[model samples]
Target: MRNNGSDVLLTAIAPIVWGSTYIVTTQFLPDFSPISVAMLRALPAGLLLLLIVRQLPRGIWWLRTFVLGALNISIFLSMLFVAAYRLPGGVAGTVAAVQPLFAVFLARLLLSSPIRPLSIVAALVGIAGVALLVLTPRAALDPIGIAAGLAGAASMAVGNILTRKWQPPVSLLTFTAWQLTAGGVLLVPVVLAFAPHLPAPTAVNLAGLAWLGLIGAALTYVLWFRGIAKLDSSVVSPLLFISPLTAVILGWTFLGQTLSPIQLAGVGFVIGSIWLSQRPAR
Candidate 1:
């Protein structure tokens, strides 16, 4: 088993890479088709990973992968995008930040991990920090969007809990491919039904797709599941705070955005909560 420190660091990379997605979407990707972008990110990355791994899942794992893929990729992405379209990004993001809390609950119910008080408190603190960091004064809540966001978080939380509970029998790469391919395959109809069409294959579009597929989906997920297999779900979940924090840093560095005093405090809360959550359990 990997040490906690190494596992934490490895898990951290997934969210940090995820943080870059916002800027990449805005600056590089073609406009206005979230479904296509999601589909392209998942499917191609999955195919590449499958090719690299060159292993198929065993019988029960086939079913498990389908279930996991649906929750983690297809449903989560679909609901997340629906929420994003209907609500302010901040609102949707804040709702999504509740995922760690959901993971806490699911971990308790599914994995039989005793609930830690500190972990719960840390999750709340992290959610508040995400809110302060992303929620705008002008933000308004739409019921549909709120529901979608909560649903997305719930789906992802269950997926994480299940992943921790059911350590795959295959190698990490093969396991990753299983989930990705299943999810990607499930997304086909959704993409066909919803997306107007695939984004034009311009140079920038291709680059954007490549980055999202290769780095964001394939590589990042491999790192994520490795952490999941090695660490508790709660331990892996709190690292998600890194996503927003990384996004803030990236925006400040690249987009010339400045953080307000409140936002800086939010950053502190996020970092502190991560530390508190990861501390040795009493």
Candidate 2:
């Protein structure tokens, strides 16, 4: 029970780290194109991790690496950056908060896990909370951003399902490194073709890049896979709700973004939903 508690706590930390991503991206990264920023985030970190692990994928795992890498890192981050660029930060985050809902459905379909009605309810409530917090009548709703966010969510859902389905023989660190490297390699052509001009890199930008590479990508993924290995996907995925809520708080406090009453209520709903979702079902 104590170990379970610790694992949950560790699992919780991954989202908290992720929640800061928006604030960091907005404040620190150069106003480069989203794909450029995404590539920068993935490539160096992936190389660093690969160097440390120094393990090559064998047999069918090579395909698994590419597929999971695309779903988890390359496609998900690219879509997320598109959403972030096109929509309000809060709205983009709200869309991302629906990840657990997608995860639940995917797990049921892919892993043959039974979906508890309570899990669905919790996901809906959490998503409602996100909507309340992020949506506004005055905000310009971009179809592209909406699609990007939903696509990002779905991509991540597929990646999580794949993680459950394919257990690599490598250590958690090695597996994560391989996936990141693969994802980064996939981004090169896209970056060259679309984002030809790189933004002027600053010390702050460098610092932000380092943080995302080391803490966000490498360490966070290590914790994520560790939790997935130990816990049910149904149990592990919903904990992601903490991310957007944390992002909201960070945005309010650090970014000087004011939260409307509706947003506050949404935050409350997200918090409550996460709490409910994390509870062990009867």
- CA shift of 76, model 1, Å: 1.8
TM-score of 1: 0.93
- Worst 10 contiguous positions by lDDT, candidate 2: 1-10
Q: Model 2 Cα displacement at 18 (Å)?
A: 1.2
For model 1, how does the per-residue alpha-carbon lDDT over 195-241 read when each residue is reduced to its tens digit?
85665588887887798889988999999999888887778889988
Error of 1 at 282 (Å): 1.5
Per-residue lDDT of 34-128 in model 2, one digit per residue for the tens? 88877888888888988987889999999999999999999998998888778777778888878899988888899888888888988999889
lDDT of each: 0.82, 0.85
C-alpha RMSD in Å of predicted model 2 compared with the true structure: 1.8
TM-score top scorer: 2
Which residue pairs come into collision in candidate 1?
A: none
- Model 2 stretches with alpha carbons more than 4 Å out: 1-3
Maximum-lDDT candidate: 2
